[model samples]
Target: MFDIRLRIPSWHRLHSFLGLGASLFFAFMFLTGTLLVFAPELDWLRYSEVRASPQGSAKLSLGTIYDAAARARPDWDIVTLVRSEGAWFADQVTGVRPEGRDAFLWVNPYTGQVNGETSSFTIHAALLRLHEALFIPGRLGKLVVTVFAIPLTATVIAGLFLYRRFWTGFFRWPRFSSRSRAWLSDLHRLIAVWSLVFFVPLVVTSLWYMVETVGLNAPATPANRTVARDQLLPPDFNGARLDAASAIAAATLPGLEVRKVILPRRPAQPIVFQGDHTAVLVRPRANAVYFHPESLEVLGAHRGEDLSLHQRIAEAADPIHFGTWGGLPTRILWGLFGVGLTALAVIGIIIHAKRVGIMQQKIAGASARSGFARVWRGMGPWGLGGWLSVGLVVTGLALLTRNFLGA
Candidate 1:
């Protein structure tokens, strides 16, 4: 039977209580995701060095950028070969490794512009795992991430309610004198109110992923090659050819910097790929692709603003969380929300510690009377039942895996 007398208060509920013990990790991820909204613009600022030229139109051709990258940094892998656009300058990384670093760079395909180098920070990836998925590894990681998503959703709901409960707490912040209780309430209420705006998108967007990937709809997205990469080469080059690759390589971005390149798959197929930094895909100013890999031809192109609705919303995920989507205002909102959640996570631990301490004292002080003993026994079955359910799930999965392998 449930322990009615020992019921958990709604106000005392934590994300962990809602099965999102790891919600903080995603919270952190959600925060940084907003920053990624302007990754293209930000990349330019973070990695490139700019200078005003004679304001010319044409820069070096695409060949120049690719060659510069390969020659300037021979040891680095070419994850991408950028061709600059008008007034942008022809620039590319020229040298880099992608696995552990930021993999950031910029080039002006016009003037053969060059930028400095930087990689993803160790702290960034580590904290990212800590926030979005709790750094869980393999299949187990998926389960943990899924479980945490539950409480994270609940926390958002509860946060809204809690915010309402403490709405008035903000008005008096500037004038009120500081003390332990006053400060705590002040901190909670103020952050909660401000946090509501930014976190709403985080919850809504991440929740979409959860519903799509983990809920009843998982099968809807199973991959079947969204499109075939038509590849054609000399029969010697397998079933592929290189029609556009050579021409595209020789092409120039006119006067702008070529942010990225989207080339059709090689050997030979009926498609083409081109990339840009400013466009958002269906959302424009975001990203995606278009192609007919068979003929090695340019069928169509997708820029940031030229994406479809579903694609736009989907693309919004990174920008929504990182602050890149809405430009400065929206990005700032996300940043504030992320910082606020971090603070919320910290305060959450304190509240739980206090409650746990109180509970321990109460349990210790209880007399060894028959009535208390009887009460404790009643709660045992509930705890035991939960444990058994978990055991059954574990066993069932193991057996299923073994049987599948045997078959």
Candidate 2:
């Protein structure tokens, strides 16, 4: 009989290979994700135009704000209006500016004044693109990013198995007085044990992303009606009827607090009021009311409570993955854990280098050829492929940045 153990690769080696292979990508993901957790606050700090002072308990009508935004950029086609959650936040109005570039205008809900405009290519938006697709265009980029989840999941599982009784490491601190490798090992285990909580959800959600991207377990397409060309809002439309439409939506969904108003720019698209109901983890888009473009009549409505089980899970993924369910406090906790995970990836490489004698070789003034050999040997089996993948992604990102900056 053949021994199964002989066929299976060593978990220790597999774990190292997987971790080392994807270390750079893992660092990129964690860093960008952590920043995205507080992207709104970061944008607020970076752009003064997004800041506003609350005038009173009530805000100006949505139509008035819409008119103000349209008046501010008469040449542009208004697309969407995102209501601000905080008293000091300015409502955002997105429009298609000349040359087809998207522009974001801040509208003060109280004063109905267009505060200022900013390009859609904000720092946070660029970070989001990098995080989601590494600047690779189309579904290919998304698939490439999602595929890494498999190795990440395997690494986490292998880590748990390798470090048996990982629970014991929870209270243990790194031994600073010990040798470099010893302390590094201790620190790696300590961080890995503590970050399991974050890793579990991250891997799970990442796998879900992969599944959805591959067309498996995809969320149901929202039901919306198409209208005729004549029914579309004209170029000179003043949005005078948006307030009545909003009132109709509020009455249609009694508890819905509208968060976004998706204006129709094309001929067939309908106006959409995306909002939140009483559902705890579902996104605002999950609970929405669609309206006819010309008549402003209610076309359809979706409530979070009415979603299918798969749909509900899909809707909850974003909030859970980003730690947005509990708002700022949870986001802060997630960011801290993310930083710890990022450090683990960096430290894992250092520990591997030290273990393989690369550090000592370099310290002893080893020849360039020997150093290169040692570095190559440290990669194990999966390292080369991982680096090649990273190289391709980096090339794509560099080209994308060049074109974007040049444009």
Candidate whose lDDT is highest: 2
lDDT of 1 by residue, 1-407 (tens): 88864665564354335323443344344444444443444544543353224344655555566555555555554445544332433254433353423253455555544554544332333344434444445445445544545557787676665456555655556325754434665675677667767667666766665654454332211111224433322223211133234354224222222345433233333222244445542232233333343333444434555555565566666556566555567656666676677676655534444444445558967534343233223222443422433343344345444433542
Global local distance difference test of model 2: 0.82
What is the TM-score of each predicted model, taking all chains together?
Answer: 0.57, 0.91
Clashes, model 1: 90
| Top candidate (TM-score) | 2
Candidate 1 stretches greater than 4 Å from native: 1-16, 19-63, 73-79, 82-143, 162-170, 174-178, 215-259, 264-296, 302-309, 354-407
lDDT, candidate 2, 1-407, per-residue tens: 98988987888988988887777778778887888877888888999988899987687777888899878898888889998777888899999987887889999888987889987776667767777877778888878888999999999998987898999999999999999989999999999999999899999999998988888764674758675686357555566788888889889999888889988777888899988788889889988999887777788888988889898889888898999888778889998998998899888877876777755665776544443344455565645855665685686579568746954
Worst 10 residues of 1 by lDDT: 217-226
lDDT of each candidate versus the true structure: 0.46, 0.82
